[model samples]
Target: MKDIPEGCMKKRGILFTDRQQDTLTIAGLSLQERMIRTLQKAGISEIFLLPQQSEEAIASLQSTSGPVVCLTTSLLLDPRLIEEFLDFPAETTEGLLCVVPRREQPLFPLPAWSAPADDTVPLPLFLCPPPLLPLLVEALQQGVQSFPALFTYLQERTKIRPRPNEGRFWYWVRGPGDVKEAEDALFQTLVKETDSPITRLIARKISLRISRLLMSTPITPNQITLFCLGIGLIGAFLFTIPHPLAQIGGALLFLLSTILDGCDGEIARLKFLESRYGGWLDLLCDNVVHVGLFLGIAIGLYRQYQVPFYLLLGGLAVFGVVASVATVCYVTLRRKKGSGPFFTSVVNEEEAKRLKPGFHLLVKINDLLARRDFSYLLVLLALLRKMDWFLWGGAIGSNLFFFSLLGIYRWGRAL
Candidate 1:
């Protein structure tokens, strides 16, 4: 379990609406139903739901045996709720736990009572969410008791109880239905962790769903890798067809293939299903697709344009040499390390770690060119359809320059 924040309040319970939207309307659930769940779970004798009007809650407080807690919305409570709490019988007022949603500004006016000056002693009340009950109970077992409030509290607990031996891995194999929900929750938590929201929300959602489903099912990661490979092969075959419509169809399939290619490793990581064979399969399939795609595009472009066969052959040579060298280096390092090497850079000790801005500029230029795989493929398709040598030369030449720099960079780093 993750460590609780030091000095963070352990809330008694949280109250919130079922709807997570900005606008509010009359909810079908009454305050009684909402309060009843938390109160029963926390073993509280009385739950006072402070509606906009305070007559009944106030009346109930007058006759209650123990301290009374009121969970209310800021808009609904206003000054009246404070007045009601203050008017409650003397010792009972200390037990007054006010629950409200989080806010940028103070939701309501602070009551007259001051918290103890020492700050070490537990406060009478807390303000937090309802999902924290198990943690709160564990803390309570240690003879620590406090009050907390929360903006929104959900009473429903997860049905699939996790075990200590599970060690986070078993959480993945629990299957698809609840898996998506778990992924959504994990995404929300992760989003709150980073400084830059670099991961696009939709991409994260897709990644999470894929991760969950892949982990839960019996499907091997190699299957996904092979599927991508087969798609890429089909794309290459489609490119060889003489029809314009067929070329377009092939390009579409190739793009889909590239996108699906992103899911395999993500699934492995989420489920702790990492294996040597799976990693090798992914690496081999990825390179094979990349080569097959361009080779097929070159074939089609050559047939359509009938330009200098030398340029097409030259492009093929450049693509093949660079791809082969990079694949060899990556595979060699992986075999040596006994694991995947993509995320780990095997930099040579002799290489300088820092570079000047001029060098940086050059590096950026090269990276952009090298990253033009999709662009080149698109250009090849366009050229095949239009019989344009200028476009074809531009695409292949740019990529050649890109790959040349990549090879040099790899060699420099390896030195």
Candidate 2:
């Protein structure tokens, strides 16, 4: 049992029936662990678990002064759904017993309980006020162990309000079939709802396929990031060798690295392994790779032709990359503070309205050019042995994009 501040509702509790213990392991973690993590992610600090016939169950009542929510451990529930229910606004006197039902459907064959006035069906989850504990205990003693039986009993005795489960994301993990269904559903849920054109068409598809394969292994997202880093550095090294074959090989390697870069994020999301450190580390590694690749291209060009122009172009291109990244970082930080973690290729609707028309147009142009897909063109140029043209184009494009963004941002602020 955990303590809550004065007047704050007692933290949510998970009630694990004896039968659920055997099927607790799903997605490499016990249901207890998964539920606890889900609560933590939802900013819930205090929590209590009521294991069947445990001393903690008795102690939980004595320690916590507020309501206790009892949910079965057999179900793999979505944390967002739980959070929404807990945060739902209601009058205190409306009901002492709250039931979450299957979305728009009844649970059992109790036609009397399935009144049209009810919005949600009674699932295995319930929130019982401290005042209703004795009644709950008495009902349990009377062999009312099942969720539907308990809900029916509560409805007959007290004002029980049914809350609808809008997103039906929970699954009862009872067998191998359930496990397979959960894996597929969770993978689908992990995919980003919106993405850039290139990411949607290429990187996302590649990443999802690779992520599905990697999830079965013990490989971590950080390891994937390191692997990408190694590939990118190798690409840079190849670019430094003054030969057409080396140049083409480097270009191919760079493209491969870009494709694989999506894997780290995909795996992290699929496994709920995302962290602030991982996000920052990914950004840092990408910047380092960009710098190395640009510098290597410049060095290789100068070595082949002994020209200062290639060196200058390389320097400019590297600067452009740095400047563009810095600008994006600054913008993301501001947006995160103002809104949330909304870092997309194109500006969101609200953000678009906030920007000047000129700035918005420039942003769209930058979005078109500043994609990983654009690197495919670089690879094609390398294969054609026209690396010089690619270098010049890169330098000019990158610099223009950065300066335009900076100027537009400043102008918007002044306006």
> What would the TM-scores of all predictions be?
0.46, 0.78
Q: What does each candidate score in C-alpha RMSD?
A: 16.3, 4.7
Least accurate stretch of 10 residues (summed lDDT) in model 2?
Answer: 90-99
**Per-residue lDDT over 281-371 for candidate 2, one digit per residue giving the tens place of the 0 to 100 score:** 6876777788788888999999999998899999999999899888877776655543122345545566667786567767677767655
Count: clashes, candidate 1: 10
Residue 4 lDDT in model 2?
A: 39
Tell me how many clashing residue pairs each candidate has.
Answer: 10, 1
Q: On residues 11-52, what C-alpha lDDT tens digit does candidate 1 reach at each position?
A: 122222222211221112122342344244344444433222
lDDT of each: 0.43, 0.68
